[model samples]
Target: MEQGLLVVLNGLVYGLLLFMLSSGLTLIVGMMGVLNLAHASFYMLGAYLAYSISTVVGFWPALVLAPLAVGVIGALVERYGLRPVHRHGHVAELLFTFGLAFVIGEIVPLIWGRLPVPYRVPAVLDVPLFALAGTAYPAYRLFMMLISLAMFCALFAALAKTRLGLVVRAALTHPDMVAMLGHDVPRVFTLVFGAGCALAGLAGVIAGNAFTTEPGMARSLGAIVFAVVVMGGLGSLSGALVASLLIGLVQTVSIGLDLPFYKALSALGITVDVGGRLHDLWLLSVNRAAPVVPYLLLVLVLATRPRGLLGSRSA
Candidate 1:
């Protein structure tokens, strides 16, 4: 029971972190219909920038400023880089962002070098928040859960209640109607793009130290973020949330389970020989397969429900 509780807690933490990274990407794709392949690059920039800013101004200020800076940069990219490519086609736009991702990936190492930067959690929040099942959970992790929940609430409220959210929702579903309604759709696009990037940056600010702050961080996380978006659905915010938590829980729990197929089957009174067809399968362990779990879930989701968990559009 204690171990089960620990797994649940860890899963919730990880799921929230995944949501932080994925919410922005889903918003951009849902509203703008652009994949924004470089979104994770923005996350990488956020971590590096936050580290630099935090060293000079402290963590509190860095939390506020780094995301704002990234938002401005995202705005510029949407204005100058993506707008021109929009005329060509989505394929061109995708290629543009893909190339930009490569460029940023190359540039990061040059600026920060290959080593991981020391982006530690603040000492004030370093103490244990509480004990659970003989384990002391860090205050920072609890703080992360609270912040992520707040973000989720803020985003939902904004989209559901505010005039701006109404506009964004209408534009996403009916761009032509929104344009005809005398709204500046291009400006809306820019703001949404920037806001999406800001969310990614905010995720980095909180998650950098918890994970790691290094040049290769984006590359490591980029695929998982994309998987979350895809599994959630191409343009569904709620779907993203559901998928993030589900994937996070599955990954965490799978990693923690040390059960080998052989032992599992033995409980059912099924025994296998060393050279039997089931031999390799029986030897496999969850720990060894943990890294592939997300992708595996992705494949299963795609195969079963191409539109994603809560996706409205049909594939």
Candidate 2:
């Protein structure tokens, strides 16, 4: 029971991190209809930046500056690179972001080298916050959870309460009407894109030490983020949150359970014949199959409710 509770708590922390990374991607898609293939590259950039900045100015300053720097870069990319490709349609935009991701991947090695950087949690937050069972939980992980929850609340308030958010939402369904009312639709797109990137950057800042700051980290995590978005629905922020948490829990819990399939079934008194036909099934362990859970959930979600859990049918 203690182990189960511990895994659930850890899963919640990891899920919030995924939501932080994915929220921006979903926001851009929901408001601007742009699918950014390079979104995770920005996340990698944030991690690297946090590592470097923290080395000099300390973690607190890095937490503020890294995301701001990433946001500015995002805005510049939108204004210069993506805006020009907008005339060619969604395919062109996707290809542009894909190419950008490749460039970032290649360039990361040149800047940070091929090794993982030493990005540690700050001293103040390095201690154990509490204990579950006999295991101590890191203060940093608790901080991460609280910060992410705050971010989610702030984002929700911005979108639901603020004037700028209203304009962005309005532009989504009625771009022409927004333009007629003298709102700058193009500028709104750029801001939304930048804000999304900022959110991803913030995730990187907090998650760098936990996940490690390395060039290949983007490639490792990129697909899972996409899966979260897809399983949540293309343009749904709330759905992304739900999917992120679900996938995070599935992954964490699976990684913790090392029992073989046969044993797992037999625990419930279901005996499988492992002598011949079902031998392979008996050999399968949860740890070995952990990485595939998210993809499997994606397939199952897509098969049953094509629009996702909280997504609209039209989405």
Candidate 3:
């Protein structure tokens, strides 16, 4: 029972982290219709920036400075890099962001080298928060959960209850109308994009030390972020939350289980005879297959609901 609870807690932590990373992309894509392929690069940039800033000032300050810096960079990219391409349609926008991601990928290695940095958790949060089933849960993980939950609440309130959110949502579906109402629609787009990137940066600042800060970190997470977005629905924040938690729990549960395919099947009162290559495949344990589970879920979700769980529009 304790082990199961631990797995669930870990899953929630992982899921919330995924939401933090993907929520920005969802906002940008949903609001502006521009798929920022370089979104994950911004996340990677945040981690690196936090690492550098923390080395000088400390983690608390880096937590604020890194996301702000990333937001500025994102705003600049939208103004100079993305605005010109906007006139050319989505294909052009996609190509530009893809190339931008490539450039950032190359530049990171040059700046940080091909090594994992020592972005360890701060000493203040490095201790155990509590014990469960004789196992200690790290306080940092709880801190991450708190931050993620707080972000969700703030973001939800902003979009669902605030004036700026009304303007942004209005601009999304009626840009000409919003522009005629004395709003700078283009400026709104820039702010939305920057805000989205800032969210990604904040996730990086928190997750870097929790996980690892490295050049390939973005590449590793990039695919899963897309999967979460697609599965949750393209523009739905609520959908993202549900999908993130679902994927997190699924992956965690898979990792926690040690049963092989045949044994798992037997538990359901089914049996299969296999041999050679097929036998080897059947012998694979659930834990060993954990990495593939999210993609499988993605495929399943896409096959069943093309619009996603709570998405109003089709992807």
Candidate 4:
């Protein structure tokens, strides 16, 4: 029971982390129709920025400064890099962002070197929060959960209940109408893009210490972020949340299980003959296959429901 609970909690932690990263992309794609392939680069930048800032000022300050810096960079990228290509349509925009992602990927290794940095959890949050089912849960994980939940609430309230949210949403479907109403529609786009990048940055800041902070971190997470966005629906925040939690739980549960492929199949009344070449494949344990679970889920979702769980429009 305790182990099961631990797995669930771990899954939630991971799911929320994914949400933090993907929510920004959802907003940008949904609102501006710009894919921003370099989105995960912003996440990597945040982690590196936080690492640098924390080394000088401390983690608390880095937590605020790093994301803000990333937001500013994102805004600049939109204003200068993406705006010119916008006139050429989405293919141009996609190509530009893809190249931009590549550039950022190369630059990071140059700046930070091709190695993982020592971005450890702050000492204050390194202790256990409480015992669950006789297992100790780290306080930092709880902190991460709280931050993610708070971000969701604040983001939801801002979009649904505030004037800016109204304007942003209006700009999405009716940019001309919004512009005619005395709003700078282009400026709105810039802000939205920046805000989205900032969210990705914030995810890096929090997750860097929790996980690993290295050059390849963005590449590792980039695919999963897109998967979550697609599975949750392209621009649906609520869908993203649901999809994030679902993927998180699935991956965690898979890792926690120790059953081998052949045995698992046998328990389901399916039998497969194990041969010399495929014996190792049949003997693969669930824990060893956990990393593949999200992609499999993505494939299933795309095959069955291409529009995603809560997405209104088909991709």
Candidate 5:
């Protein structure tokens, strides 16, 4: 029971981090209708920037400056790379972002080398915040959860309450009408893209210590993100949030579980008298299969709800 509880808690923390990344991606897609494939590259950039700065100065400075730098990079990409591509169509815009991801992937290794950088949690947060049933929960993970939650709240408030958010919401649903009213659609699109990339950067920073900060981190994460966004729907921010949390929990919990579905089937159904490595293979599959749970969920979600859960029907 205690172990199960810890696993569930960890799932929640990871889910929040995924939400932070997905929130921005969803908003960008929902509002601008552009599928920015380079989103995860921003995450990798954030981790690298933090690692570099922390080495030069300290973790504190890196935390503050890395996201800011990434935001600028995202803004510049929007101004130069994406804007020109946008004129073509959403598919072309997607391909443009995809190309950018590969470029960033190559550039990261050039700048930081192929090895994973050593990035530990700050000394202040190195120790666990508290113990749960003798299990120590690291302070950094707690801090990450809090920060992600706070960001989500702020984002929700900004999108739902503020005047700027109202305009964004309006444009997301009806860009043509909003433009007809003389609103600067281009500026809004750029800002939304920047904001989305900034969120990805922030997630990278938080996850860097928890996971390894490697040049290829973004390459590993980018596809899962696309799956999350697509599973959530094209333009629904709420759907993105829900989908992220769901995937996060699914992935984390699946790892800690030992369902051994195939092995169980041997006992329930007619037993295939497997000998030697076959038995061991089934045993190994129990653990190895857990890692793929989120992707399976993504496929299932896409298969069933092409529009995604809680996704906006239009725009």
Candidate 6:
């Protein structure tokens, strides 16, 4: 029972982390209509920046500053890298971002070195928040939950109740119409791209210690983040929130389940040996299939709703 609860807790954390990363990716894809493969590279930049800054100052300062720095970097990329290529169409944007991803993957290790740099949670946040059924829950994780929740709430309010949100939606759904209205849509796009990258950067800072400050970590996890955005429904903030929380919970609980459902089936007169990676031959299919959950969700959701759950209603 305790184990089950713990799994749920961890899953929520992971999902939130994914949401933070994917929300930005989904919005950019849906709004900007640019599938940036380098989105995860921004996440990696956030980690290395935090590591460097935190090493000199502190984690809290790094958390606040790194996203800002990454945001500036994203804005520059939008102005120079993406804009000139905009006229060439989305394939160009995709290729550009893909190239940028490789560049960042190479550059980060050069700047931070090839090691998985240590990212200690702030000393104040290092202690356990509480123990549940003999399991200690780290305070930093709880802090992470709060920060993520707060960011989600702020994003929700901004989109649901503010002028900026309405403008962004108008731009996303009707770029030409917004421009006809004299709005500088390219500016808005740049801002949106920067904001989205900022969210990814923020998640990188929070997850640096909880996960790793490694160069390849972003590459390993990039697809999953993209998967979450696709699964949650492109450009839908509510969908992103729901998908983030749901994915977080699902991944967490599934990975920790110990029930060997397949292994136990023999007692019930059903038995079969599976052939796959030895890593996947588990009694519990959830544990075996843990890493691919987001992709599965992405495939299922896209099959049913290609525009995404909260995507713009096509004319």
Among these predictions, the greatest lDDT belongs to 4
Residue-level lDDT tens digits of model 3 in 193-265: 9999999999999999999999999999999999999899997888999999999999999898899988877
Per-residue alpha-carbon lDDT of model 2 for 1-315, expressed as tens digits?
A: 998988998899989999998999988887777789999999999999999999999999999999999999999999999999999999999999999999999998999999999999999999998888889999999999999999999999998999998998898778899999999999999999999999889999999888789899889889999989888987788999999999999899989978997887798799888787878868799778889999999999998988877777434
On the 0 to 100 scale, the lDDT of residue 73 in model 4 is: 97
Write down the worst ten-residue block by lDDT for model 1: 259-268
**Order of all candidates by lDDT, from best down to worst?**
4, 3, 2, 1, 5, 6
What tens digits encode model 6's per-residue C-alpha lDDT throughout 61-149? 89899999999999899988999999999899899999999999999888888989988888899998888889899999988888888
Residue 110 miss distance in model 1 (angstroms): 2.3
TM-score of 3: 0.94
lDDT of each: 0.90, 0.90, 0.93, 0.93, 0.83, 0.83
By TM-score, the better pick of 1 and 2 is 1
The Cα error of candidate 2 at residue 127, in Å, is 0.7
Per-residue lDDT for 1-315 in model 1, tens only?
987988888899989988988999998998878898999999998998899999999999999999999889999999999998999998999999999999988888899888999999999988998887889889999888988999999999999999999999999989889999999998899999998998899898999977899988888889999999999998788899999999999999889878886775677798767468777777898778888989999999989999888888753
Q: Is candidate 1 or candidate 4 better by lDDT?
A: 4
- The lowest-lDDT stretch of 10 consecutive residues in candidate 4 is 272-281
TM-score of each: 0.94, 0.94, 0.94, 0.92, 0.89, 0.89
Look at candidate 1 and give me any clashing residue pairs: none
Question: Candidate 4 residues 1-315, lDDT tens each?
Answer: 777888989999999999999999999999888777899999999999999999999999999999999999999999999999999999999999999999999999999899999998999999998998888899999999999999999999999999999999998778999999999999999999999999999999999999999999999999999999999998899999999999999999988779988888898899988776789989999889999999899889989998998998897
lDDT string, candidate 5, 80-171, tens digits: 98898788998899899889989999999998899998988889989978888899989888899988988988988998999889889899
Separately for all candidates shown, the number of backbone clashes (residues 3 or more apart, or on different chains) is 0, 0, 0, 0, 1, 4
Off by over 4 Å in 2: 262-279, 313-315
Cα lDDT of candidate 3 equals 0.93
* Model 4 Cα shift for residue 280 (angstroms): 8.5
Candidates 2 and 3 compared: the better one by lDDT is 3
